[model samples]
Target: MSKIDSAERARALDLVPVSRETAERLDVIVALLEKWQRTINLVAPATLPQLWTRHVADSLQLVPLAGQVTRWVDLGSGGGFPGLVVAAALAEIPAADVTLVESDSRKAAFLREAARVAELPVTVVPARIEQVAAQLAPGVEVVSARALAPLSRLIELAHPFLAKGAVGLFLKGQDVDNELTESAKSWRISSRIAPSLTDRSGRILIVTSAVPLAPIKEAAGNAKGSTHD
Candidate 1:
């Protein structure tokens, strides 16, 4: 395989300030991501070159929003965005853990390897989101997803986690208002959208409460229809 430019990757990581240890782990994960992308299509082809800023930084921004809490559940952790990234940060905390749920076997394998390479404390669940939410939700303090599904759908899959008192931190692009509007009609939700540090067009959704106000019958079937993990 051709060599990935470490200098360039480090420059991209400079966008977000991290501890030296976390920086080393992220650097390693970047190289591993580039290596895995060659075979499994871990992330989008267009975004691969900017993984540090576009994915890593964007994912890392969620850590502060969640305070000192640990125990996270990242659904559809395809490329291990905020999930594994957060795990690397929480590795120093004795009680910290991030459970990555990915149904795709190949992606799950990549996630497992990435965590091992970074030595982050992550539990890779090679199963669908619905299968594990029931067993994992109650103890979780945070639940996250990125480009996993639409806003309405995200709320549905995260319900189990939120209902169990976990905070939801989801990375969403510009259409967030529309998604929130659509979601409000079916579910009574308590959420806040914050600016993303990595991208001007992106938003970080912090959801605290969600209750079913009504059922959606159309395309997505009230969020439950689309469970990415």
Candidate 2:
């Protein structure tokens, strides 16, 4: 891997400042990611040069939005972007933990190693989202995803947790407006959109309530074909 520019790293830290301990932990994660990238595809090749600003800072920006919530679930935690970074920041807080859900075995292994090496409080769940969503939903305070799926599909995957009152913080790009419009068709979502601190075109979607809208055809059929006494 090529060397990261010191200036870029400085800029990212400036955007989301952290204590020395947290910075060191994040450094370990970045180093481990670079080492593992040679064997497995951890992140996009083009983004490596700006990894700190693009990935690290982008992930770190979610920490503050989370407030004091300690128990977090990061869905599709590929390369541990916001998951590991959030865990690293919360490592010192009491009872603070982040669960990284990644189905790919190799990536899961990397997440485990990164958490172990950084001594961050994290659980690496190596199962598909649907397989473990129920088991992990209870007691979760925050649910997050970065570049995972469309807002509509994401709601489906995160429904179990959202229904349980866990807030959803999803990182989206320029097309977020379109995704929200698409998601509205099947879900009544109470959400707020915040501009991302790291990218000009990026946005962070905060969803507090997501209720599934009954299929129009199903409702129509029930109204026309069924009668109750």
- Clash number for candidate 2: 0
In model 2, the runs with Cα more than 4 Å from the true position are 215-229
Q: What is the Cα-based lDDT of residue 85 in candidate 2?
A: 93
lDDT by residue for model 1 (1-229), tens: 5344445456556766788898888877878878887888777777666677777878888888999987998988887886888898788888888999888888889889999989999999988776678789988999999888888778878888999999999999889999999988889889999998878899999999999886633343222211221
Error of 2 at 58 (Å): 0.1
- What candidate 1 gets wrong by more than 4 Å, as runs, is 1-12, 215-229
The global Cα lDDT (0 to 1) of model 2 is 0.85
Expressed as tens digits, the lDDT of each residue in 164-205 for candidate 2 is 999999888989989999989899999999999988999999
Give per-residue lDDT, candidate 2, residue 141: 93
Q: How close is candidate 2 to the true structure, as a TM-score?
A: 0.92
Worst 10 residues of 2 by lDDT: 220-229
